[model samples]
Target: MLTFEEKLTIIESFPELTRNDISLGRVNFHFEESVKDKKVVVYRLHPNGNGFVYAGEIENSDYVTDSKGMVNIRDFTEKELRDVIQQSIASLSESETVTETWINNEGQTLKLIETSGVWNIYAGDDLDATHATYHAAADYLYQEGFRLL
Candidate 1:
């Protein structure tokens, strides 16, 4: 495991991340432009380092309010930390929702989702109903009172 100072040096290398030293010898990194507004904290030496990177608004995840779907970065190497930080910041700019959606004049909505190598459709955010192909998903949507828009 890298020492706190070593970690700090590596973290400081990223100019986009502003540093803020918190209590108990811990450090927090801030990305002001991030949609998921939260300080990325890398802890002092601990078995389960509180260090984490925000992963945006993911539901059904372990992250609580203080962490907007933060993923733990415990005992990370230089490469690992850099990669996680990059990905976390990147995630802030991306749509967290996994499905693509569209609505009709009547306000009824449809969604096309791709997961686990299969295409699926939903009335709104989602519904498990998997379709075999993109064409199949499109057909399902067409049959459900939706049109290409």
Candidate 2:
């Protein structure tokens, strides 16, 4: 089992994470640049060497999560710790970095952009509409008798 200090050292290795101590000697790591709902990844470590990591949207596999869907990091190695932390941070970061422009069949120009997971459609010269997802934004224009060019 990894000691508490060993776990702390491994967690501090990630530069993107900022450590904040909570009540009961527990610590929380917050990814400031994250624009998603899970910017904070939960890490609970106990003196008994029992610990857990929750990186949002857990997968099912050996040592992945309990029936409650929490990752047991009690016996996790340095590699295991690093991998989970990296994934946790990435899962909350913005998924898009560029804007794309397309034209409709009627020759109307449409600019598609995503900001903090909100998709926007700019038709012609101004921001025309907003949608929750990129696909939804595209679908809205399609329903307006717009066809991809």
Candidate 3:
């Protein structure tokens, strides 16, 4: 079984992850990207020399991997570690969502909906338009001085 120091050393080896951003607990090492978003990736190490990497809050297999097959986190080399972290970063970047109800000076409520990589804009009960990216949607809203709620 990997000791606490060994686990910490492996985790800190990631250049993107600052050692200060890691919280080493008795059984898990919680490492987070220093982004504005609140989501984090956790490595839950078991006492049996095995572990799993959980990407987000939801308990699913999408970004979850165990110590088996192509994914054994316990046996990952430095290159594999970089690949995993890069994968997680890419996933997190694409998962960014913009959901807010903004009110304009004219008391108009503009709804911003982001789903499946598409941005939908609605003015009241009618769908005003759709944007291909969150930036485009936000830019349209900003043109009208909408205050997010």
Candidate 4:
């Protein structure tokens, strides 16, 4: 396992990591506290590479993609990746909650209902309107630190 210091060093040196914005040439890391204090980190590599986010514990391995894309991490080691994931989880566990709203494109009212593992969308009089509404809702949830499965 990579130590915290080692992880910090790798993160600082890695040209792929971006702490400021989520765009090409940047990686956005977020930690979620809801899932047993789980940490989530997302990497948005340059357009040429696959964009993905690695998340989970340092002792055990777990990862998920931010989007469907590929990336080359030749400069980093497995331990470094582990450290980054660990640090990200720690950081997100202490963050504040951010709320956002989702609007229907057709002026149809939409509602967010908490389901067991996912958030459900309910549209008023228009199931088709759910497409845009859910898209906005997913975006809002992602911005607020929720991951889609």
Q: Local distance difference test, per candidate?
A: 0.58, 0.67, 0.54, 0.40
> What lDDT tens digits, residue by residue, belong to model 1 across residues 1-66?
666666677777766777776677666787666655554533333323547666554333333335
Model 1: CA > 4 A from native: 39-50, 56-68, 94-149
Instruction: Tell me which residue pairs clash in candidate 4.
Output: 31-92, 39-89, 50-69, 50-70, 53-66
Flag the better candidate by lDDT, 3 or 4: 3
Per-residue lDDT over 10-117 for candidate 3, one digit per residue giving the tens place of the 0 to 100 score: 666544444333234324433354342633443445444455444343222343444321244666554444445444443444353548888989887887867445
* lDDT value for model 2: 0.67
Q: Best by lDDT, which number? A: 2
Please give, for residues 1-149, the per-residue lDDT of candidate 4 as tens digits.
Answer: 33334544555553333454555555454433334443335555333433344533322233332343222332446554544443344333433222233454444344454322223443331111112354666776555444532
RMSD of each: 11.3, 12.7, 13.4, 14.3
Which order, best to worst by lDDT? 2, 1, 3, 4
Candidate 1 TM-score to native = 0.47
Worst 10 residues of 1 by lDDT: 41-50
TM-score of every model versus the real structure: 0.47, 0.54, 0.34, 0.23
Which candidate order results from sorting by TM-score in descending order? 2, 1, 3, 4
Model 2 segments more than 4 A misplaced: 58-63, 66-69, 96-149
Worst 10 residues of 2 by lDDT: 55-64
Model 3 stretches astray by more than 4 angstroms: 1-4, 15-38, 55-72, 94-149
Q: Candidate 2, residues 1-149: lDDT per residue as tens digits?
A: 68888988888877777888876787767778877655556456665666677644532224456654458788888767766765565456666443776676667778776755567675542347767887898888778767655
